[model samples]
Target: MTATLMTGTDLAAEMVAKAADRARALQERTGVQPCLATVLVGDDPASATYVRMKQNRSKKAGIGSRSVVLPAETTTEDLVAELTKLSEDPAVHGILLQHPVPAQIDERAAFEAIDPAKDVDGVTTRSFGAMAFGEPGFRSATPGGIMRLLEAYDVPIAGAHAVVIGRSPILGKPVGMLLLASNATVTYTHSRTTDLPAIVRTADIVVAAVGRANFLQGDWLKPGAVVVDAGYNEGNVGDVDFAAAAEVASLITPVPGGVGPMTIALLLEQAVDAAEAQTA
Candidate 1:
């Protein structure tokens, strides 16, 4: 059977449209709109582009967004103060601090400043614990999108062996946690893992988030395995070698069109949900 290409952009657009309808209905009855606050440090081109795309999508979905852009020289204490201020703002329903803050800034401290209820980006330790425990809390956007994609396509998670290649707090670890929540046995690998290809070959579901270009080869995938490529390297290439994996796998997510758009979509969705909860 030919591999099914999972287009996250298409799915994300559909989700945003549906969420827009919900937002409108909620606003009509409650006279309240969902709002997201995005904080950015430094001037990384890719981060800036991502933040802009999220803001644009939020607008399209009838959600409000406020952006706080800080300079490269911004101190860690100053960043934490800013995030704390946003967390306390009644008008801000959701808070997202873009990753890769300047080297001098303590990113973890900044993330911890966000209130769990408003941590729609799911970066805080509280959010992580909630996800691990399968509690009622916002999920990391990319992981949430991955699970949504799987459910949308009816990919079985229960009783499956899923191998996640990466261990970053935002993407790799969180995605594995989500899969585990869905009853999938999870094995997490990273750059230091030996026999990486062998580990991937044993997985019924493979998630590549190692940030290395074309790291997962076609021959390494189990035939008919489901592959989700969450890595986006320079020039928009993903971690898995898509052409190769597609030839062997049953289902796969592409680089630019796969997991990227869905991240922003889920962020907007959670932002709307947070807003509704605040107004309720």
Candidate 2:
């Protein structure tokens, strides 16, 4: 039997359109459009493209976007000052600082400057804590999107063994917490994990977010497993080898067509949510 490919792009587009309608209604009701402030430092081509894509999608979703482009030589303090300003601006509902800001800039310091209420990207430590403890607050966008995808597909999560590879605070770790919140038994593994394939073989569900190009192998997947590939590596490749994994797993997400689009869609949707929350 051919495994079902769960590409999120089409689904995400549908979600964005639905969200846009809601955002427009909210704007009409309150005369306040939800705005996201996206901060980019230096001229990394990939980062530039990602930010542009986000802004375009946001506008299409009836959400407003503000961009800040800092010089390559910008200091951490300079970045923090801008974030602080955005945080204090009631008109800006969410702030997203694209990763790999610069070696000279302290990324965490910049993330912490975003007010929790406006932390739509869910990179702030405050949001991290809330997610870890299962408290109510904004969640990391990509992780939240993954959950939304699962729900949209009607995947059963409760009592499932969810094995998550990678442990980064923004993406991987937050995803594990969310799986746990859904009552899944979660196991996190990283580079140092011994016999990684053996561990992955036990998972009923798997989430690959290690940012490596086709790192997870197909043979490692349990037959009938539900797979979520969160890696957006160079050339639009994913952590799990989609061609191979699809043959093994019951449901698998493609690299370019899977988690990537959903992430940005969720970001814009959350930005609108944050704006409405602020206005209310």
Error of 1 at 250 (Å): 0.2
- Candidate 1 lDDT over residue span 36-105, tens digit each: 8999999999999988888888898998899999998999999999999998999889998999899998
RMSD of each: 1.1, 1.1
Positional deviation of residue 90's Cα in model 2 after best superposition, in angstroms: 1.6
Model 1 ranges with Cα > 4 A deviation: none
Candidate 2 residue-wise lDDT, 133-193, digit = tens:
9997888999998998888888899999999999998999999999999999999999999
What TM-score number comes out for model 2? 0.97
Instruction: Give candidate 2 regions above 4 Å deviation.
Output: none
lDDT of 2 at 225: 95
lDDT of 1: 0.90
Q: What is the TM-score of each candidate against the true structure?
A: 0.97, 0.97
Clashing pairs in 2: none
For each candidate in the order shown, give its overall lDDT on alpha carbons: 0.90, 0.90
